[model samples]
Structures are given as structure tokens and as C-alpha cells.
Target: MDLSSSTVVENTNDFRATSIPTTINGLRFYHELDEWQQDNHFIRSGYVKGTNSYKSSFNSLFYIHNETGNIYSHLLPSLVIAGSLVYYLKFQLPLYESHLQVWEWINFLQFGFAATFCLAMSSIFHCIKSHSHSVARFGNQLDYFGIIILITCSLISIMVFAYHREPKFKYGFSCLFLVLGSICTFLTLDPKFSTSVYRPIRSTMFILFGLSGVVPIVSAVNTYGLEVTKRKAGLNWLIWEGVLYISGAVLYAMRVPERFSHVEQDQASLLNNPMVGKFDIWGHSHQIFHVLVVIAAFCHWKGLVQCYHTMHQDMLA
Candidate 1:
């Protein structure tokens, strides 16, 4: 069937009215993951498989599909955050007293690099996952790489900049996490953990990596006192960041809050459980996870901003 340049029908009746075809151009959606995973579909609908070129795959952003939430969840943020970073940099150019040192601006750019790259790569993976198995796999690796960037960059900013007084510990743990992130990225790229059986293993790796931040947290508390650390170090903010991340990780691992009455869809009904199939286009755990990821990143950003203000106050004091 020729479905290229076709408008995505959001209504259930019209969507279902179109008879399912073996293959189509990259404008339709697929209901199941395997439909496109096994085929080079550009735009697979809820129940159909369709092929698409790179242009169509790129254009997939504007169309509605199950993957729309996943794509834009990170894609839009990527653009907005990047633009804001540039604008803020320019805004600070004329302030002599408020100006950051050269190294400080470097750190800011590095931090921005981590945030922007993670979001951008996430969008790329979700947008191009339908291109082919190779493309999807590449996207997954890019996603893993993005995760490493976020974690590593966050650690650098938190430990080094936030606790500039503790030079040894700051640089020490920063490198430690960077090395660990590199290792985890390698493991995730192995493709051995892509199967269902190894899914928990991959998730556990990420949790452990994030949990390693305790070293820095304890160091800060010990040096500054609990109350001072909480205020100056933005401990509460980081705690919220941790909470958001752990919550998202739990959802991704458990796939909760996803329910479907449509028992007929093969992938969503694997368990034959009626409570899990209704969330294909929305409310799926991955989508929820993506949203939480963004919020958590912002929480981290806010905490960093707080840290910067505290640093500034200290320098002036």
C-alpha cells in the first residue's frame, strides 16, 4: 500500500478503517515492536509495517504515532535547552562583576554539552528506530553513550565545581565515575543485554553507577556540616534529582502504569493480562520514563545553579 505523504489519522475509526498491509511507506504506525524491528519500516503504524527513507524518518517527528511521545520527549527539550544555553552565555558577556572565570565558562559549556548531547541522541534513537535493525541498534548505543555523558558530566560539575575546596576528592571521584561510566557504556554496547533476560542486569548497572554519588555526598556533608551542606551544596535539590531518577528507573524496569483493554495486540498482550495493553500510544512506562528523565536532568541543572550562586557568594565573602 502507498501511504507516503499520508496524514496520520488520530481517530480510532479511520485508523482501523485502513486495511493492514504487509508493507507501506514511512507514514503509518506499527502496533508491535517486532513489526518494525524485523522490517525496515520508515513509519510503522499500530498494526502495520511500512518502509521509509531517511527523509521520512526525519519527518516522523511531526506525525502522530506510538513513538511520538518518546521522540519529542527528548527532541524538543534538546532544542530548547541548547538555545537557552547559548542565549545565557551571550547574556553574561557584558557583566564584569557577575562574569565567570574562563575555566568556569568552560565547565558550563561542558555541562551543556552533556545535557544537550544526551537529549539529542535520545531523540535520534526514538526517531530513527524504525529505519532498520542496524539503525535501531546504533540508536541504542548512542542512547547508552548519552547516558554516560549525563552521568559523567553531572559528577564533574557536582563534585569539582560544588566542592572546589576539596581538590583531591573532587577530581578523584570525578575521574572514578568517568572511568566507571566508560565501562558501563562498553557493557551496554555489547548487545548481550538487549534480550529480556538481561534487561534487569542493564538496569542494575545504571542504578549502581548513580548510587556511587554517595561518596561525594558523604564527603560534602562531612566537610560542611549537614545543614550547611544541605543549603550550600544544594543537597536537597540533588536528593530530589536522585529521587526522580530512581523513580524513572523503577518505571522503566517495572513497566508500571501501562494498561490496555485491547487484548488483541500481540506484543501488549503477551501476558494475556488485560491490565497492560491500553497504553500503547500514551501512558506507557517508557514515555513516562522519558518525561521523568527530563525533569531529573532539570533538577540537576537547578542544583548546579544553586551551587554556582553559593560559590559566587563564597568568593565575594
Candidate 2:
């Protein structure tokens, strides 16, 4: 116990207990030597940080955090759908010998309608699904309306195609019927039914929208019997369209694998979230809806092509 040695030992002990600096909320914190850096791993490195700012909305395309992933998951396929329509117009439509002067215009309108419907549906789905009770309630209702609008637009596009091919038919009748159906559906979506209490009403409206296709489809098929290749192609198009539609409906209504594993899927990555991410993009219910829509559009295009071909052959005869 020499005095100088004792003094040196005390200083070394004090040094061992000195604190190290850390940061949180832009404020520096200090911890004793033993505790120093114990929580450092909890501090997120800037390199691995997730986007928290609304400014990185574009990041939704690549990142995996809540809304960003879901938003882009819906958007990418929409772009594909738009591109497919453009390809049809530029490359496919001109190949057909259509006489309708406004056929191109109608196709453009249909493309616009489909694109808008997709965007609206995506907005509604992402906006409401993760929100609070009030938000979920109101947002879900709006989402439902968006879905209805999408269905209506698709049905209208089908009728438009039919009208383009058979201008003799009264376009006004189809327009009036569509408008009336839309108004009726909107009115009948009683707020009471808006709750899960009457899911059947919501489902019925969807069915009505789908069933409306029967008018033009039957007219086209009956007028141009299966002897005509164009008629056969039209039938094939309708069949594929129906398949995509039914598959999508089943995936959506059942919620599939995600339904059984809600907790695991409630928060997911693009690699995960089978229902909303994987199946939802090109495979999801809405994507399937979009695919069916495109199939229907292509079917309409095929019918138009067949009509032009048949009419040209008839003139030659």
C-alpha cells in the first residue's frame, strides 16, 4: 500500500468506469464502460435503413416496408396491362381489315378506362387495409365502390367492342342500360349492407356486372355462328376471360394461404405476402382481374378481326 501506487490504482479504476458516447434522436447519450455499445446493434445503420418519408414514394417499387411494397406490387402489372393494350393497337389491330372509322378511338377509350380502374382499385386497397377502425370502415366502403366502378368500366368496354363491330345495333341502348345499372347498384349498396352483415349484396353487384357481358357476348356469338373462325376465336376469348375471372374471384373470396396464416402474412415482403405481394401482382386476385380484362379485350379484338376477315371474304365471293 505505497501512497503513489494507491493513487495510480484509484485513477485506473476510475478510467475503467468512464462512459462511452452513443446517439438517439440526434441526442448523444453516455454509458459506463461495461454497458458501452451494448445497445448499439439496435441503432439502425444508415446503409440498411428503411424509407420513412413520404418523399420516397417511388421507393415503393423496390423497398420492403408496409405500404411501399404493396403500392408498387399493384402498379407494375398495371404498366404491363397498359403496354399490352398499346401493343395490340400498334401491331395487332392494324392487321385486321376493320371498316369502323372509330374503332381505334374506342380501343383507346377502353384502355384509359381499364388503367383508371386499376389505379383506383390499388389506391383503395392500400389506403384502407392497415388503418384504424374508422379508416378501415370508410376506406373499405370507398374501396368497394372503386371495385364496382372497375367492374362497370370493364362491362362497358365489352359493349363498346360489340358496338364497334356491329354498328347496326343501337349503342344508345347499351349506354343507357349501363348507366341505369350503375346508378341502381350504387343506390342499392345500403350502408347497412356495407357492413359484413350483407356481403351477399356486394357479391350480387359483382355478379350483375359480370352477367351484363352476356348481352353482347350472346349477340356476337349467335350472329356469327361457329362455322366462322372469327366466331370460334371470339368464343375462345370469352372462355379464357371467364377462366381468369373465376380464378381471381376464388383467390380473393377465399383469401387462400394467407387466410390461414394471417399473423405471418399481416406484414410481409415482396418475397413474402403471398396473397398481396406474389399472387397479387400477376397472380393475385386483382391482377387476375386485370388479366381477365385484358383477355376480354383481346377476345374483342379477335372478334373484330374475324368479322373483318369474313366480310372481306364475303365481298370476294
| lDDT (0 to 1) per candidate | 0.70, 0.47
Models, CA RMSD each: 6.9, 14.4
The window of 10 residues in a row where model 1 has the poorest summed lDDT is 39-48
Per-residue error for 63 in candidate 1, Å, reads: 1.8
Q: For residues 199-289, write the lDDT of model 2, one tens digit per residue.
A: 4455555656666666666666577655553342344665665566555555544544333322221112312423322221223343444
What TM-score does structure 2 among the candidates reach? 0.55
Model 1 per-residue lDDT tens digits across residues 1-317: 23431322223324343533224333343434553363212223342133345666777666566678888999889888898778877785335345678877777788788989998999898888767667777888898789878988887887756777778887798889989988988788786555545656767788788888888888888888898787666788889888888888887776556522333333323344434335655667778888988898888877777777787777788
What TM-score goes with each of the models? 0.81, 0.55
Q: Taking the candidates one at a time, how many backbone clashes does each contain? A: 14, 3
User: How well does model 1 score by local distance difference test?
Assistant: 0.70
Model 2 clash pairs are 279-283, 279-284, 280-284
Worst 10 residues of 2 by lDDT: 39-48
